[model samples]
Target: MRSWAEAERAEVGRARLRVSVLVALAIALMIAFVGGIAYVVMVHAQETQVSRELRYNARYGVPGIAPRCAWVFVLEDGTLHEGDLEVPRGFPLRDDIDAVHASRGSIERDVKANGTEYMVLTAPGADGTTVQAVFDLRYQLLDRAHLLLALAIALVAGLLLAALVGLTISRRTVGPWAEALARQRRFVTDASHELRTPIARAHLRAQVLAAGLPADQRTDLDALARSIRGLADVVDDLLASAQLQERRDRVPVDLTDVAEAAVVGETERATERRITVLLDHPGRPVLVGGIETGLRRAADELLANALRHTPEGGRISVSVRTVAGQAELVVADNGDGFHPAEAERLFERSHRGPGEGRFGLGLALVREIVTGHGGTVEAVGRPGAGARFTLRLPLAEAGLPVGGEHMTGACP
Candidate 1:
């Protein structure tokens, strides 16, 4: 399973891909729209030029012009007079001439004769005669075909170039996000390492001083020691959360033993607070595959969180069992419970609820450890009622049993 950071990077890549595709589509549509307008303008211009040349030939006949426009003159009595211009064979026949003469006003029309296209124009001559002129449209049609072909090639080339440029821009745009994430991870790792040394030295010095103190001073020294321990625990949690991405070593672990050992370790703290800590289990081994140290730390954090919240005389319970091919650990505490609205945010880093003397790192560490093991952790609670944290991890294969004795260890 990919880590959350890796999954986020993948999602960014997908978003970049979507942006590139949209950009390419926009470029393609723009080219098509512009190309269509240019095509229409060019066709209209060609038609207008053809009509102008036909009208000119009708009024003042050109003799033997290139590709020859045919001309005819009709008197008021409807007598036909063919002009000096030579009409092509099977073109501008008598019926075409009559249609042109019968037109009421100056107008242009297209006619096809013997597989050839012609643009015809009709107008009244200065001498009370009707004039008609026809020009061949083959060359104009061929030019339009070439223009369309050129536009198509341009459209394809433009689309490909747009796609290439879009891909490059997308990569450049997402690069900063990747760099920022890398820097954040590095800072967390370096800062956590730097903090561990001083905390360890302070904890050591406190232990020594507490050992030498007298009975009356011993309580104050012990309290100081506990405070130092809590600080160390925070440092450890920060280090573990930072290093989770780097730790992938897995082994078969007995969760039942881990839960029992975590309970034993917190027994002193619970007793001091007058809270009842109960370990409920069938004593049967529950096997899971994960990092044993990380799993133990997760269990410890859960237990610590429960102990910290439970009031004096309140009950805390820890249990481990296997259900539906998964190993489950449940930690419940009867204390001033949290609001249901805040339950989901309880495991977020550095988020504190309505409580005093809370560092807010315990539940976050537990969430990180369990998630690193390809497991899930959830909290459920109602105000003034109680809170339950449940963790579910995939069980190891039945034949790959790890002994509980090997899994027994003190929580960090």
Candidate 2:
């Protein structure tokens, strides 16, 4: 239970972190996009306004009477005339003014000097002479810089806010899911616990009645006993499955040993049913990392499933080996098999095949256990051809002798 709680907490923590990161990224991107558009628009408008001011000063204005951040100079009759205005470092742009006067066309260009940008325009002035205008762009550059700084600060704050919001949302969303899971597990556990004693008593009664009945009339009583026993087994399986994920004592387990034990456990029943049970393995230990009891139960379920399905005198093989850094435990039976398409759905909980004759909790629990251990289980078979279940787990150690020793024997 402590382990289950820890695992659930870890799962929720990871989900919340993931949500926070995604939300932060989304908000950051949006802020960046909007800030970029605004910056672009501001710069464009500033440029258009600056150009308009320069043109207007050039067209009709004296040098000292130019608008704010603007300076003008007139070149008429090869003489410069500017009404005592403070000129910038590179004044008048004499080359451009002369070029415009000679070419009789306007010359416009941008220059950067004196720690600021300047836009200059030289065109026809009064009396067909030349006029030069220069606009200072220091205030515009400062405004852009301030905007960028503010956007940076806003982005940082927005990311923090977004992360907080994401965490809150994730907590609220996942809280109910985790609670529902806890409730379901508790219900299964409580239900299974409550049902165990009655099933056991019913099984005991059925067995007693079977024993007391006459040999000729014992057939139905024996069937009833078997049915009750099956019910008890199902209940036990449910309980085990409910408690599977709560187990945290994962250790190195030998797959070969597990297989052999499962086959031995069913030896008596297989012998009684007149089924040929084959136990095949590498003889040596194939190590995997998992809770030993859960793995043992999985192996037992597989072998028992095969044994139960195989007809009298039929064959059931329990094989364990190592392949490609993985331990493969396969159980195959030559008995009443299922359709090829039903292979995947066979592992779903309480999924019964045609006429309600199929595995319920056994295969499903096997899947849950194997998946919890970061392994895989596969099923494949053709109807009337028998079924095969392959459970694979990663090897606890590399180079653990693949197929070093092969042994095959039939269990009595």
**What tens-digit string does per-residue lDDT give for candidate 1 at 1-412?**
3443565567778978887888899888998999899889989998889877887777786334434445544434577665456667754455655655676466667888756688877666665666667788878888888988998998899889988988988888877876787677668768877877777777678778888878778876676765666556555545554553643335688888889878877877889899888888777878788766667778988888787778888999998888787899999999878899898898888888665667888888788778877899999998778899999999876565453322111112
TM-score of every candidate: 0.56, 0.66
**In order, what lDDT does every prediction score?**
0.74, 0.81
lDDT of 1: 0.74
TM-score of predicted structure 2: 0.66
lDDT measured at residue 372 in model 2 versus the true structure, 0 to 100: 80
- Candidate 2 lDDT (Cα, 0 to 1): 0.81
Model 1 lowest lDDT segment of ten: 403-412
Candidate 1 Cα outliers beyond 4 Å, as residue runs: 1-159, 192-247, 339-342, 345-351, 354-365, 398-412
